[model samples]
Target: MDTGKKVGDLFGRLGKVPGRGVGIGLQLLVGAGGLAYGVSQSMYTVEGGHRAIIFSRLGGVQNEVYAEGLHFRIPWFHYPIIYDIRSRPRSISSPTGSKDLQMVNISLRVLARPDAVALPRIYRQLGTDYDERVLPSICNEVLKSVVAKFNASQLITQRSQVSLLVRKELTERARDFNIILDDVAITELSFGKEYTAAVESKQVAQQEAQRAQFLVEKAKQERQQKIVQAEGEAQAALLLGDAVTKNPGYLKLRKIRAAQSIARTIAQSNNRAYLDANTLMLNLTDLGYDQGATRAGTSKK
Candidate 1:
């Protein structure tokens, strides 16, 4: 019984010591946690649409790029730089001058991606924020240079060509920085107020000029119509004069026909009408062709 109590006391005293089994256990726990942390750091995952590049403390950036999947690296000697290799959208805007010295505001939309194969070079030179570093600079450069080659009117008229030129130049330029442009476009464009007003005024003036030309043509056509009418009236008068001179009885015949038409009109009227020698229409009856006797009134026998 004394031996058992003494052994129990000894164990209790050892447990109360400043550092022994407890210190060793704490040290072992710390070592295990550090080892677990290092292993976790050594293994990384590259998700879909992402790429990775390695930087070695001793050897510098590796020339090879890592693709999506599980990848391994030396925990302390190497660091991984991950990049989004997917096409992403970015825009740039600038106020620039045209070839005609007109102020123009333009915006460009770029669909860009880091060249998958050039990821190593990109990390070596440009680092992770490659798009931020290169896109705006190249967009502005291309926009300004392309805009300067066109007049304000041409810029509006040849907008498609301008966009094409910008895309070509910007693509070539961004390529140098290990950036690939999936697509490029000039999304917005506007001219200065003064230039816009001038364009509108010029269009209005052209319309007015066209209207004036139309009016002049209309007047010419009307004048031609009047000249043709006058010629026809003169020719008809000449024909009548020659007929009267050639046959003296023609005037008498014409007069007789006019009297007949007037008499018929009066006869057909609904109102009662009376006639005397002066008031009655002359030569209305079908009188014979002897002038003296016809002038003498003849009733139908």
Candidate 2:
């Protein structure tokens, strides 16, 4: 009976301990909260236009890369480093020497992005600031190399070609560092003030030469037209003289026609002559009437 009473007393004490089951539940709840916090920490969401590279504490960088979305990893051991895969623009001003040893200032724009397939390699080699580390230097080197192959005037005239060559060289070089070169443009090209002045002077001189040539051609054309007119007039006078030599009666016929034309003009005038019709007929001999009469008389005989 005494041992039973002592056991009942121990049970009563254990029951009397306030909220013992609640204490055990609270401990379990704290443990679950910690586990949930750790799981939350292990999950990450990569946003649009971004990719994540996982780094393992024990194994180093993982081959697998995470695309834009939710991803899971081991808590505290694996972390995601996000990189922007969007195309970015960079402008660089490079001063270089031309083939003619002229100082050329070139402003260029480069559109570039990291190779998505080689992002891991790029991160390993160049990190997040890959553009800053690799592109500017490569662009400068390639631009200078291309510029050295062309003269200052060529840079102005063959700007597109120069840009193409630079793009090609830059693309090849950038590929070595796992970068994609989308496009390259030469925005501006300038030379020294003296060179510009010389070019302007040359253009002005060429224009003046063209104007002078045009004036000379115009003078030649006018001289040719005058010479042709004089030749035509001389040929016409010579034809007339030959016609007169071939037929002596042609002059007498012309004189008669002129006299008849004068008679018609005098008849049409407003002023009346006081001469009689007989006087007019007598005056007709002055034209070739007498010659015609002699020819007729000889023919009849």
Candidate 3:
């Protein structure tokens, strides 16, 4: 009787619980939730300026790449590796030896991007660490090669040319690894302290030499000017001596002109003096008047 009472009590408690349909509904809800979560996990998104490659556990790397949009893959089996395909700027400081055996320190800026079409190949070859793994070695090698061709002074003078050579060589080398080199710049070039001091000394010496050359040229010009002035004076003296020797009446005529000028000045002054023609004629004999008369007589004969 107790066992029948206990079984009846168990049946009564079970009837008070929820029905089987409710249990089935709850299990369905749980399964649907799990499916939705799995679907969400299977869906992946690639943002703008980014690219993705798929790695499958069973089939290796998928050749097709996903661009910036929604993508789907098998859950727990396939993975998406994303890469930033923007132009990346990287700086490198390298110590190299110049052709003249001088130590040179070079700072460079490199603009690089991966070739989108060959991204899969890039990942396979260099993985995602392309900047760290590939760029440094290539840049260093090319820089060293280019630097080796130039002396330390040439490095400063032909900085642009050196940069161009490096960019050209690096572009070709990086293409082999599926990278595109956009541009390169040499930001800084430095040498040893002894080299810098020597350069300064040489510049100072050149400036001093130029100044000395200018002074020498100025002295030569001054000396030439003085010689020209002396020659002019000598020519004038010779012309005067020739005039005196060739014409005896020339000095007498000059004296007469000077006397006339003095008489005009006296006439214009507040205090005036008048000399008669007889007095002027009397003074003419004392002032070499006979020389003029004799020259006139000779011309007439």
Cα lDDT of model 3 by residue, 32-120, tens digit: 99999999989999999999999999988889988999999998899999999898999998999999998888988998888888888
Q: Write the per-residue lDDT of candidate 1 for residues 203-296, one digit (tens) a residue.
A: 9999999999999999999999999999999999999777665654666687677777867988999987777633543643434544533343
Which residue pairs overlap in candidate 1's backbone? none
Regions more than 4 Å wrong, model 3: 1-25, 238-301
Best TM-score among the predictions, by candidate number: 3
Model 3, global lDDT? 0.87
Q: Regarding lDDT, does 1 or 3 come out ahead?
A: 3
lDDT of 2 by residue, 197-275 (tens): 9989999999999999999999999999999999999998888666555655555576667767767878999997665
Q: Per TM-score, what order, best first?
A: 3, 2, 1
Cα lDDT, all candidates: 0.86, 0.85, 0.87
Report how far off residue 241 is in candidate 3 (Å).
Answer: 6.1
* TM-score of candidate 1 relative to the true fold: 0.70
